[model samples]
Target: MKIQQITKEVSIKRSVDSGTEEQRKTVQQIIRTVREQGDQALFDYTKQFDQVELTSLKVTQEEIDQAYENMKQEHIDIIKEAAANIRKFHEKQLRETWLYADQHGSVLGQKMTPLDSVGVYVPGGTAAYPSSVLMNVMPAKVAGVKRIAMVSPPGKTTSLPDGVLVAANEAGVKEIWKVGGSQAVAALAYGTETIRPVDKIVGPGNIYVALAKREVFGDIDIDMIAGPSEITILADETAIPRELAADLLSQAEHDMRASSVLVTTSQNIAEQTAIEVERQLADLPRYEIAKQSIENYGAIYVADNLFQALDVVNQLAPEHLEVMTKNPFEIVKHIRHAGAIFLGRYSSEPVGDYFAGPNHVLPTNGTARFSSPLSVDDFMKKSSIIAYSEEALQRNYEKIAAFARLEGLEAHARAVEARFK
Candidate 1:
């Protein structure tokens, strides 16, 4: 509710980018216990934590099939429509392994190949995000990954969310497990008796799930270790007050810690936007969460000018950035970092999340400074290929031999030297 001027320096340490240390310690313990006791440990943890009593750790094919029967045709149709959007967007990223031959008939190039398998982690609760299921699986399917597995916690009141199972089925996930939390990550990373270890893991999750992913980096691949959602709006006098308010509240609905900030050159616009936010907040379903987030993490800055506002944006590197200014594209040319940039007044972040082509699994907590959103490239690998004819080997043998000798290993030189001998 308070407005402040943006000086050359930020005063609030620009907010620290870190996970809670206590959460990390708790998650590490979960990972170790699950790794040691396997399914038994997982069941105990699930009952102790999620308050669910499960007979099996894996979601059966019957469960997935029944999920379809319970859903309305219209809801299924929407999932299909969303899947088509996700597939269409990711298809542009598909690639084939390539080879090139020189005039000498020597072949050399990098081979692009899909990873052998990947695991997707979906959070579980009364409300489920079928969108996340599609986002995590469609890209791997697009990349031609052979096996895609899913691990989501089971619900206590009802079965796993129908949309979740339906989306996973539509996206070609090979296996689905009724497990979640750090234990799910450990199972996916280390392989339980029933679940096989996967080449990579991708999805949105809580603090424990994130820390578990962080600990599993070497044993398996993971998507970015994300933090709370954040959105930054860089505007001038031209920014639409009503639209900017909607965008700020969009991210605030994600969590109490999620951040939404409006930085502009015009104080008048800032005040108007704040008023618009208050008006719109009354209607949103998650108003309490959004309000708490805004009260604690939200901010308004009246910069000296558009250039100064843009400078603050670079320092924040928010997960979702909106350019709500005259000539949004013109102003974006100078911007360097953001998980996703919505260039115009009409392009809100939620459109990209539910229906638009790009992935919503973006870096958060200022990680966009160095990381990128999830994509097909995250589910593929490249193997370098090299081949040489005898004549070519003979030409380079002396240099190769010298390089080995310089490293103080004569056996390495002899391996090549013997060929020339």
Candidate 2:
């Protein structure tokens, strides 16, 4: 980890991977083939990429039961409890269709409707993240989406991970598929023989999956193109160095591109945290990955004061921000941009990642400046409601026509005039 003195506003903006020409071309071809061949394309791709032969695309009840058998009862209970917590949190974001009327007999409002269907992509291979399943699906379910489909590439045994399956079941997802990569995204965008098209696709995956989402974006909605995990800790003299290092490495271990940064007022704390991070890296199972991440992207900045440190945080707009100052609440008001804010020493970033009610699917890179975490609103669409009584129309029709004519939209002017006549 490198330590530097903060002198001016700094940006930790990383270049987002947009895929190579070859990869983009390949994704386009994959999408085209799935649209043309449907289920056969998915099966062929599964065999080629995943090395698993599948007779069917969908997960069966027997498989779900077997998944339950494979998982420990305690693990299942934990997933259920996590699901309950997630659902309870998202249910608060649920909205009702509303309309308002005035004395003029004009009604205007917004009608909120959940998407008809959604597809959630859960990554497979070296690790399985059941937490992601809960984070992605619970919001759609809370918004009253009728169908939620889950897709993950199969392993050699031709089975999805037990934890992933259990989480999906607990989150109320009925449809699960044993396919992944660009092809699964294609299948979700354009209906296959067995899998129907969904209105939107959510969740995280590899570069190929991100490319596929980008390819099919306009045709079918997708969540943001997520970047590597990042955590920026803002601490003071009162903060513990070891705890700060541990929290930073939690994200560093995620990927080689993950970034861990500390901006603090105390130089002593900065030097100690850098040493603590190096010390902790030795024990991490993903040592090489974390070590590389810290070497390339990690940094500790010595700020003149708390105000100067916060300016850097706002400029970076990190995916995860941890405030470990003496008074985190006071510091929180100064933070304008962060995907998720974990305040004080006890609220570690991992708490929000798993057990905490907040959705872990948050904007990465500097996108936190403009976007937000995945919520129930992402799974729902709003329709503008407009109603005008005859009296109201008579009063405003000429003015409406004149305004339309001012824009040289004669047809629009005639429409309002015709309504009045």
Q: Which one wins on TM-score?
A: 2
> Per-candidate RMSD vs. true structure?
2.2, 1.0
Cα deviation of 15, candidate 1, in Å: 6.6
For model 2, how does the per-residue alpha-carbon lDDT over 290-399 read when each residue is reduced to its tens digit? 99889888989999988999999999999999999998999877899999999999999999999878999999988899999999999999999999989899999999
The global C-alpha lDDT for each of the candidates, from Candidate 1 onward, is: 0.86, 0.93
Winning candidate number (lDDT) = 2
Residue 18, model 1: Cα distance from true site in angstroms: 5.2
TM-score of decoy 2:
0.98
Q: Which segments of candidate 1 are over 4 A away from where they belong?
A: 10-22
